[model samples]
Target: MAVKVAIFDWDGTLVDSVEHIADSLHQAATELGYPALERAAYRNIIGLGIEEALESLYPGITRADMQAMREGYGRYFFTKATTPREVFAGVTEMLADLRGAGLGRAVATGKSRRGLDKALVSSGLGVHFDITRCADETRSKPDPAMLGEILRFYRIEPDEAVMIGDTIYDMEMAQRIGMPAIGVEWGVHDQDTLAAFGPKAIVDSMADLRRALELL
Candidate 1:
């Protein structure tokens, strides 16, 4: 079936926030008195929930320590939030094309509910999405709950929706639901990493994505 719903990821997919994200993780690690984590350590967990990501990086930390790290990351991020980053080229056009094709637009993100909400308005794409599910509100990526909820909300089956994202977590989550996944190269994970999760296609640019999804 043709894709009637296009579910997107926020951070590295639509917008470019890797620098800020890395800085926040570093600050959080520092605040928690953990030695600064290597870039690769934190970068790989970008698609997970705050608790899950921190736990993955620190593996042996206590609940309180995780909470402290989470809080510190949020604080550090907000403090550095000066100018908002623009979405990838043709992103707005992509959304418009999807809308014009009568395809439903949604977001399944690793960010917290508040973080996703803030990004929606700040990025000026709030009006484009018909639904959004955040990490705090559901099981994080690589789990199918978020995609399942979106499909249920729209009363559509997995095949009718396409997951568009930049990370392996996003691809894995879609695979769990038997939905098609399209990976983007500009995100946290490289093409090979995302490909191992079995995406339908991995596009190098927004233009290529348009062709892959037939958004045009």
Candidate 2:
């Protein structure tokens, strides 16, 4: 079947916010007196929902502590972090090309609704998406719930849509539903890690991504 919609992951996929995310997570842990993890440890959890990511990072955290960490991370990410949250090079053009081709554009991200909304406005990429699903609003990545919802909303089968992201979580979620996925190299996980999930292609640049989309 021809691809009708392209579902994207935010953070490292579309925006260059990985460092900021890692730094914010570190700050959050510090604020809560949690043990600091390596940058790679924080990056590895990029595609998971905040709570899920926290649990993965800090096992045995209480519910109250989890809430505090969430809030602390939010404050640092939204206000304190100095890292620029610019959109990746060619992302705007890629999205515009998808629009030109009449392919539906959407985001399935681990970010909360509030975080995504703010990002959408700041990035000016909001209008490009036809729909978006946040982790806080639905099941996080690797679960297939968010991807399932996007497929249903578009009334398209899993094969008719493609999930493009930089993490194994995104690839795994799409894989569970038998959907085609394209992995990008600029995100949380490396090519080998993403390849383990059996994506249709692993691209290093937006131009390569466009070509991969065509071949799919």
Query: How do the residues 39-92 of candidate 2 rate in per-residue lDDT, one tens digit apiece?
Result: 999999998999999999999999999999999999899983222248888888
Clash count in backbone of candidate 2: 0
* lDDT, residue 179, candidate 1: 95
Q: Tell me how far the alpha carbon of residue 130 in candidate 1 is from the true structure, in angstroms, after superposition.
A: 0.3
What are the per-residue Cα lDDT tens digits for candidate 1 across 1-216? 288899999988988887788889998888768988788777889989888898888889999888888888888877743234467777888898788878899999999998888878877888889999999998988898999999999999999999999899999999989999999999899988989988888999888898898841
Reference-based TM-score of each model: 0.95, 0.97
Residue-level lDDT for 133 in candidate 2: 98
Which stretch of 10 consecutive residues in model 2 shows the poorest summed lDDT? 80-89
* Alpha-carbon lDDT, every model: 0.87, 0.92
The candidate maximizing TM-score is: 2
The TM-score that candidate 1 achieves is 0.95
Q: Quick one: RMSD of model 1?
A: 1.7
- Cα RMSD of predicted structure 2: 1.7
Clashes of each: 0, 0
Output the lDDT of residue 46, model 1: 93
lDDT of 2: 0.92
